[model samples]
Target: MDGERLFCDIALAARIERAEARLIAESSGAARARRGDSVGFARPFAGGVASFAEADSPFDKVAGLGFAGVPDAAELDEIERAFAELGAPVQIELCQLADAAVGAFLTGRGYRLESYENVLGRRVGDATFPDGVRYCRDDELETWLAEVADAFAVADTEGLPSHEEFPRGTVIDAMRDMAGVLRFVAERDGDFAGGASFRVTDGIAQFTGAATVPVHRRRGVQTALLRARLAVAAEAGCDIAVVTTQPGSKSQQNVQRQGFDLLYARAILVKGTSAISSSGADSRQAS
Candidate 1:
C-alpha cells in the first residue's frame, strides 16, 4: 500500500486497541452500552463522550469530541460547550480518508492544534530478536515512571497539565486495568538504558511510554525496545502492533527502520485556559 493508506491502517488499529482498554476499565453500566459488540460509546464523565472499537475494526470509538464529520460547526460548538460545562477536554480520532472540511472546522475555532503524531505499524511476519536486550514480564514500574517524568521536563510546559494532574500513580492505575502489559528493559553493564510497555487489546498491541535515559542516547536502546516488544506482541497472537511518535522525531525514524509504515497524523488541541483557571482557584484555597 501507499504511505498514506498504510499510516491510516496503523492509526485505526491503535485507536481500536485504546478503545478496548477503556471498555475493560469502564463500569458494568458503561460496558452494557457495548451490548456484546466490539464497538460502543460511553460518557465516562459529564459532557465528555468516548467512542471505542475493538481491534481489527475500521470504525473508531468516539472517546471524546473530535471525531470526523461531527455534523457541522453548530455540533462542534455544542460538543465544546458540553466539554466546557464539565471542565473536561475533548478528544477524537479520524481516519486519513476524513474530508479536509473536518480539519478546517476544528482549526477554524480557537482549538489551538497541539500535537500531530504519526501512527506506525508492521505485520507480525518474522520473529527477529534484538541482541543484548533482555525481555521480561516484570519491570521496574516506579523507576520507569520517574524516567518518563524526567524526560518530559524538557517538553513544552506552558498551559499543559502538570505531573500532578496526570501523575505516575495514575498511569500505573491505568496499566493495572489493561489486559496484559509486556515490558522490555534494556540494560548495559547492569545499568538501566531504556524500556517500553506493550499493552494488548483485542489482538492488537499498543506500544506506549517508550523512553531511554539521557545517559544512554544513541546506544540503540530504543530500537532494541521496539524489537523486543513487537516480538512479544506477535507471540501473544497479535496480528499487528501500533505506536505513535512525533513527526520527524527519532522515535519515528527508529520505527520506520523496524519496518513500521507511517499512518496519518492527528492534531492534539488543548482547552487548557479553563483548566488552568480552575486549578488556580484550588491552589489559592489550599494556600
Candidate 2:
C-alpha cells in the first residue's frame, strides 16, 4: 500500500479500538442499570470482535463489531446472521482499509451504503480567537441548533442534502447524551456568527458540526469557534482534537489551515429499514 493508504489503515485501527472501548463502557453502564451481568467481548474464530448488550429480553442488541486481519466470507456471514437475529438494525463501520470484497459482500446482502466523512485531527496549541466569542455547554442547544441550521444553509449547495432534511435535532441529542460535550459559539454585534460541538473521550476530543453563518463567512467565525473548542478540550486534559470533513471541500481546507492533519477517510454507510418489532420491553431511552 502507498503511504496515504497505510496512514488510513493505521488510523482506522486506532478508531476501531477507541470505539470498542466506548461501546464496552456504554454496555457496562446499561447492564448495571438493569442489575444484570455485563456481557464480554466475543472473539470470532475467523477474526473480529462482537459484543451484545441484553435489553431486558432475549432480543440481542449489537453494541459493537469490527473486523480486521482479512476476514473470510464465512465470518461476514456469521456476523450478518447474528445481527439479523437480533431483530434490530445493526450499525457496522467499514474503513477504507477494509478488503474490497467486504463492500460487495454487504451489498449482496442488501446492505445499502450511505454517508461519508474524512476524519481529521490536530494537537492542542495556542490559537487566537476572534474577540467576543463565548463557550457554553449543553444548555444552549436551541441557540446552537439555530446557528447550525443557518450555517448549513451557507455550507450546502445544489445537489446536496439540505439542512431541513438532515436530523439536526438527533445530532444535538446524541451530543448531549455523550458525556464531556463542549459546545461553543461565536457572537458578534449580538448576532450568532459560528458554532461548534465536540466530545472528549479517551483523551481525544472529537470535533463535529463546526460551521459559520453565510454572512459571517471569511470573517474568522469558524476559526474562532474551533479555537475556543480546542482550548476547552485542552483544559479538560485532552491530548488532541479530531474532526472530519468531505475530501477536497472548503471545510477540509479550513481545517488544514488550522493545523489539523488528514488522518483518514471513511465512508459512512447507513441503511434504512422498516420498523422492527420488539419482544423486549422498550428499555432504550429517547435522546
Candidate 3:
C-alpha cells in the first residue's frame, strides 16, 4: 500500500466513523456535541456512550502531553462525565489514525481493549446492476429491513438463525425510522432475497447492515447489492465508499475482491459503569 494513501484513507475513515456514531446517537435520542478535538455521544440503549478522534493537534499543542491533540486530560475526564450523564457505561473507540499516545493514555487510565475491527474503503466504481437488484423504495422499507434482519439473525458464522427463525420487524422499524439511513433490497427470481443499508456524508458513504438469507448465499446477492450501492453513492456525488468488518471475516474477503483495502484497525475500548466507583460519580442522576 502507498504510505500516503494509507494514512489519508485512515484519516478520512475516522471522519466517517464519527459521522456514523453521531447519526446513531442522535437517532437514539442521545445528546451529541463536538468538544474541542473529540465528538462525545450518549444514548439510552444498551450500547455505551463514548468519543472518537481528537481534533487537529499532532502534539504541537499542550506542550506534548495531551493524546491525539486533545487540549488536556479533561478530554477523557469529560467523556467519563458524559457517559454518566447518559446513564451508560463509557466505551471509547479509538481509530488507528489517532496518535499512538492516546492508546497508552487510555490504558493507563483503566480502559480495557474490547474488540478490533477493520475499516475498509475504496473509490466507488461503476458496475452494471446485476439481475434482480434495485434501489429500495421508501414504502418497501419494512420488507428490506426484514430481509436484512433475517440475513444477520445467524447463530453461527454462516448467518443461519440459531433458533431456526428469522426476525420480521421491531429492529427493522427502528432503523427505518432513523434519519439519513437508506436501504436497498435484492430480488431473486421475483422473491425478496437480500438487502443492505447505507448513509452518505462529506462526499463519502458507509455501506452498513448488509445481509443475505442462507438459501440466498453464493448467488452473488451481496456483491450485487454492494456494487449497486456504490453506483448510487457515486451519483449522489460521493467519492469514497467505506465499510467496517471484523478483521478476518468472510465479508472482508468479499469486499477485498472488489478492490477495497484495509485502511486501519480500530480498537473498541470500554470502561465499566462500576469502574466509576472511586470517582464518586454514581449517585448523580443523568441529565
* Each prediction's TM-score versus the true structure: 0.64, 0.63, 0.71
**Residue-wise lDDT of candidate 2 within 169-213, one digit each (tens)?**
434333333334566778878887777767666777767557777
The candidate, 1 or 2, that scores higher on TM-score is 1
Arranged by TM-score, best first = 3, 1, 2
TM-score winner among the candidates? 3
Count of clashes, each model: 8, 3, 1
After superposition, which runs of candidate 3 have C-alpha atoms over 4 Å from their true positions?
A: 1-11, 29-68, 85-87, 155-170, 273-287
**Most accurate candidate by lDDT:** 3
Encode model 3's per-residue lDDT on 27-115: one tens digit a residue.
43321222232343333221222332221111000111122353246655775676555455555556777677767876888877655
Comparison by TM-score, 1 against 3, better one: 3
- Output candidate 3 Cα RMSD: 10.5
Task: Provide the lDDT at 60 for model 1.
Answer: 19
- The lDDT for every candidate, in the order shown, is 0.50, 0.52, 0.55
